[model samples]
Target: MSAIRHALTTKRADDFSAWYQEVISAADMAEESGVRGCMVIKPWGYGIWERIQRLMDDRIKAAGVQNCYFPIFIPLKNFEREASHVDGFAKEMAVVTHHRLIADGKGGLIPDPEAKLEEPLVVRPTSETIIGDAMARWIQSWRDLPLLTNQWANVVRWEMRTRMFLRTSEFLWQEGHTAHATREDALEETHRALEMYRACAEDDLALPVIAGEKPENERFPGAVETWSIEAMMQDGKALQAGTSHYLGTNFAHAAGIQYQDKEGGQQFCHTTSWGVSTRLIGGVIMTHGDDDGLRVPPRIAPHQVVIIPMLRETPEDEALLDYCEDLRKLVAAQAALGEPVRVLLDKKPGKAAAKRWDWVRKGAPLIVEVGPRDMAEGNVAVLRRDRLWNQDNGKPAFSFVSREDFSAQAPALLEAIQQALYDEARERRDANVTRGVTSMDQVAAHFADNHARPGWVEVQWSKPTSAALEAATEQLKALKLTIRNVPRDAEPADGTCIFTGAPATERILVARAY
Candidate 1:
């Protein structure tokens, strides 16, 4: 009967891209630095990253991977060692040719010509080449095989077109590099990392993903096989959330990572690398964010529950503060999703209603508001971000419960919100995917409307190679689509290829991507 007033000025239905930018700004997440294609992550934004780092680090460590630090500056020659690897990143690599800056005649600083280095150093884009060099020296015998190492660091890539966390010129990520004695071992590690990413995305971040092997064209340049977890955004575009690459003996051969076998024979190592980055934060935003803003999953939310005491700046305010503080302690002690609940009590100088809306935009999983009257009545108002609106009344769906009961139910409440968000996203993704598309023309017709939210299509293909593959890619390009991946769990193809009309060997998902 009444229209609900959304917190964000840009509605998602009106424009998803604009709405995404608005969420980042209104939620105080991050902003552009003066520098082009870079962002300054604010407290709230960095806080979310910290939570992701902690949880993902735990999984990394659990896989028997030792953490290590690598230099941010890598020798250009190291990249030159692997031609394909170097070519893949050459355009985006930021090179350092001069050691120092000097004053120009115009009173501005410029690179000193006299301080040029013998060889340019590249800002680390990905560390396989450099890390492979280390493996060559550290691994001497078969006993040293299966060397698993990971590093958490920032990397630079000169992205021409950029978006905040999605395509920044500089971003933070963890790269896992391992050297194995055999191809089977390396491939096993590759799949292990893929499963880890799927679990992390689905369980930790509440993102349901399709884990599959990428086509030859989409494989990491030097990789024999590359795998990725593809997630569907609310707008029906695909986000390659994370990737794991099986490099065969490519880098090992280039870097001379040889180990002596039991028979005293030297052999090249098979290597695998997998990584997930801050772009995952972007995926979470697109996957779970709504018109109001982000509804962070409880497991990854910096503060799962935020408590705001409705203070009036009067004598009664002190009593309300004490009541809210007590409530905060109670909620923090309760365990949710295998950890103590994270709760914050806001006692800042502001009206409670304003603060409540601020937290709503930030998508705090639960917001508990207590007023003097509520304290007198021994009750508190709880708002769940996942269920923000009441359809019948067009108002916030706030539930009033007694203080003792609210604290007792906090853990289940947070867990429920987490599951609800994941289910909602999963359902939407499942519904939007168009299957039974048997021809290229059908695929073209399905995505004809640029304004409509056109999702993905799962079509059968002949698994073309070399020239044929290139032709298939060009055909898809003409339709403004690309193959996302061949899902690991897809049904065996019993039809003809959509492109060449050959007997289909596999099924691939085609979609527009970020």
Candidate 2:
């Protein structure tokens, strides 16, 4: 009936990028660290990351992978052993030349020339080279095959351009590496990792993703094949949420990871590396954030339900807070998403309305407020982040319910929110994908305007090789798009290739990505 004023100053429609940055700030998730291409993840942001880590680690360990840590500084010689790996990351690697620092006499410190080591070290961008060396030492026979290991760590890439969580110079992530005895086993593990990412992103994070195989040109530097889970952001751009690379024997050969078989012969192990990073947080913001702020999916929300007592700083405030505390305990006891509900009672000194908006902006799944009147009536006012406003009144869509009833229904409500977010994202993604485009001309025309929010195009392709592939890539580059992936469940191609005009073999998704 009337215009609704949103909590956020920036609206997604007006400018998505600015809106994204605004959400990060208004939600208290993160901010620029004053260093180029780096950010400081605040408590709320790190809390979300911790939840994701706990949930994802459970999934990783369930697959029989063991946790381990590696040195942050990898020897330059280690990367030199893998030419392709070095070539791929050369521009981004942060090299450590000297071991110590000295005063420059100008009140600043500089690397001490005298402390230079015989060999330079590279801050790890990825662990393939270093992990390969460990696998080589740890495995000597078939009994040690399928050595599964993972590490949660930070990596430096020296990015020239960065956003808070999306593409920073440094970011946190979990990298899974495994060595298999045969090519078949390695491929299976790769697919398993991809499926794991798909399930985690969809079920846990409520970000529906398309799991697919990347083309040769998009594969990891030394990988034989690479697969990724791509999620569509609200702005119609694709975010590569996670990737699983079937490295084959490339890294094993580089690190000399050989094992003796029952036949008494030595063979290089086939390897796979897969990872998901903080970038998924960025995906969540773009996928579920509204004009008001972020609408975090319940499964990954640090605090699913937050109770803010409507404190008046009077004697009656005690009773309201006591009632809210009881409600918090009840909600916390209830199970949701196969875990105990995480609910917080905000007893901090603040106005209830102010605190409610604070939690709302932070994307807490549910916010409950109890006043003296509500306490006397044994009721609470609840606001669902996913359904924030009532257009009829241009006000917050608050529901009044008895405390006992709300506590009993908390688990189901959370599960529903998680499913609803996933459904919304999936529907949007499916609708935006333009299918059955037959030619490069059509694809170009469809995304001709740079400012237009053209989602993606599914077209038939011959899966060209070498020079032909390069030419096809240049054509797409001219349109500021790239081949996102070839969906694993796509229909068999029945038309000619859009680029080469040859008989098409598979369907590939083309889109502009983050």
Candidate 3:
């Protein structure tokens, strides 16, 4: 057996949580940072995020939101202006108290007791509070009503538990904050942003997702409505990939974001905020990755193709390295979906198998090995990352294609891999989704079943009475499941809530999510 074949020790089906960390280690995407709850994203991981950021930024700009920045710290008073927002993020906030540090007599530096600040600053968990304050100052009249802005920045949430790329004390993200004169415009902007998220997830990342509004309990703090894109992972857990919030006048009123109307009347502006963070990297990991190793969607892969020169440079075989180099240039020059195909030439000295699986573990979309025989045959051996396991035995299974044909179709081939991953994931999700659960027993059975992937279960939700909603909330919480969303255009259902016998509306998706 190849050592590289055993790169990941835990099978995803057997122990998903352990396999996730193992995949990250084998892939060398990230590592735990010196800070207890933070993580350091390695270059390969950051490269993927850089792709995500660039694509997302273009879409955001198209939506008329300009890129900008906000202070990382919020005055404690600013955070307290919105009571619900403060309550929601209070436990996770990191407060800064002192202004300076002083050398102690013993030689260690300590926070200067005399340098205490009059008002403590809270490291922003999200920029709504801080950005809201800025929005108020920036918008004083009707002409300034639609204040659309986005910021790419890091935030400190101080989460108790941590996972690489998923949840941590600090992470990189792009947050968009906008203000509109009319509620309709704000809502429209919110939905538009949500649609953009859906496109980026399904089309660009090749991950199928359901775009919907979050339930009240799961809504962003202080927002009137919250929209999300949720993707099901291979382990049957749903990952909330991105979110857009319709904040109404909550933040505007709280921050005094008043704009004078054409009629000389002053009114609060409606607001919206949406964001996707490094957590989407986690989504990519669990969605497309297999037990052998990570399999990045071709579009987001750092290096779509890596070429290894399998060399034994006798006078007859001396041309093999030259052939590999020619092939690399041929592949890179071809465009894939308007972007130059990213290709790498792996010339590092080592066991060829070890070198080959390193690229496999890192999830490069394609691996081509060029040798003396291949050079003479005018062909290249290809091992597609997605089809790495489609072999009769442990022996390396590589399919050969003529050099001319491979070079010409490289772009389309990447597209095919991207499509294949999406199709497979969608099939799994569709297969496991159990709809119209008419009873609590059925709901319990669906969630408790460990035999197959429990992608999603749809239940008709009651038109929320406080007592009944609370009961259902507590029940679902006990079962370790939560409603992913109540889709905006979900078809109405005539059934009753599975948790309670109360009359219900449309279906809301429920599952255990990341």
Candidate 4:
């Protein structure tokens, strides 16, 4: 049997929820924080997010957006600027009522009401309100126009129900806020930003997504339109990977972000905001994970290749250790992402088998084992996480390749694993997407029947509205299904709404989401 085959206690097919939690625990990725609804991303997990940050920040900068920091606390009055916008976030906001903590002489510290400020402050649920206020002050003319800025920061929302990386009271993310003098320019910026998100999700994270405009009921509050990239997880659930929004002067109107036009008249700037949070870590975890553990995409994995040296206290063991060290340097010096390839040489004194299993649970894309025998053969044993899940397909836990061949194949292997993960996810999605369904009963049956990994079904709807879909809301909720998106790439189709019987022209994606 493959050494890492039985590492996980649960089968993904038997109990997916428990399997997911187990994978996170076994992988040592993240854990609950002392504060409710917050998470402490361990080094292994944070390392992956750091890779994501580097890749995403580079892409954001290339798109001409500058990074900046914003105050974490906003005055309560700021939220009142855009009533609808603040209304959307009011329930999740964390408010600061007192300025100091004092001993109440009961052996516990209490909030000092006497030190309260004139107005309460809100911990940033989102930066749109405060950023909009800043834009109002920064803009004076059309030349000072498009204030394109992004901030990599932590935000707090009082989430009642929370998960580690998916939904937390506090999480790390990048929120982009941009202002444009013209509506056309603002919309273009919005689209470009969303494309960046799609590029990052698909190209780097190896998660395939359907890019589309959200239904009105699902659009971000105060956004004229919200564009999103939604990816299907292995368990047949949709994960909203990222989003972009066009504000259409709504925030500008509220915050007084105006600029003098070429004709010397003042006009409100059209605005846009978009963000992707740490929730993406969860998306990646679910998208490519299997019964064994996380099959983290190489582009985002902290360590692309981890080399384990199978050593012993023998005269020849020194040579094997030397070979492993040399191989590490050789692999680390090679460039794949324009940065040094992250390589780890596991030299801890322990059982080689256990060490091998350790990296397997960690989901390092490639694991190489070098031993005295391997040194004599001029080759190394390679264990790929992407391939470890395929033991049932008659594949070995690890394969043997010449040292030279392995070094040469290092970059290609990473790319191959990356592409394979994406292709597999896409295949799962395509296989389950039901077609030519024209009735609410059919839709419900499709969702209910996929067993454990029920996936998405693309249905053509004439009237793609919440009201139209809500006709079967009770039945659909019983099935735990909802419309994922009105795909921007959806081609014109001839059909009617399954429930409303309205003439349909576009396809809507339906699935249960995370």
Clashes of each: 0, 0, 0, 3
Residue pair clashes in candidate 2: none
Arrange candidates, best lDDT first: 1, 2, 3, 4
Q: Tell me, by lDDT, which candidate is best.
A: 1
Q: What is the alpha-carbon lDDT for the whole of candidate 4?
A: 0.86
- List candidate 2 stretches off by more than 4 Å: 449-452
RMSD of each: 1.0, 1.1, 2.1, 2.1
For residues 1-514, write the lDDT of model 1, one tens digit per residue.
5899999999889989999999999889999899989999998889999999999999999999999998888999998888788779999989999999999989899999999999899999999988988999999999998899999999999999999999999999999999999999999999999999999999999999999999999989799999999999999999999999999999999999999999999999999999999999999999989889988999899999999998888998999999999899888889999999999998898998999999999999999999988999999999999999998899999999998899999999999999999999999999988999999888888988664778889999999999999999999999879999999999999999998999999999999999
Give one digit per residue, the lDDT tens place, for model 4 in 253-318: 999999999999999999999999899999988888787778889899899999988877668877
TM-score of each prediction: 0.99, 0.98, 0.96, 0.95
Clashing pairs in 1: none
Evaluation by lDDT, superior candidate among 1 and 2 = 1
Q: State the weakest 10-residue window (summed lDDT) of model 1.
A: 447-456
Residue runs of model 1 more than 4 Å from their true location after superposition: 449-451
Poorest lDDT segment (10 consecutive residues) of candidate 3? 311-320
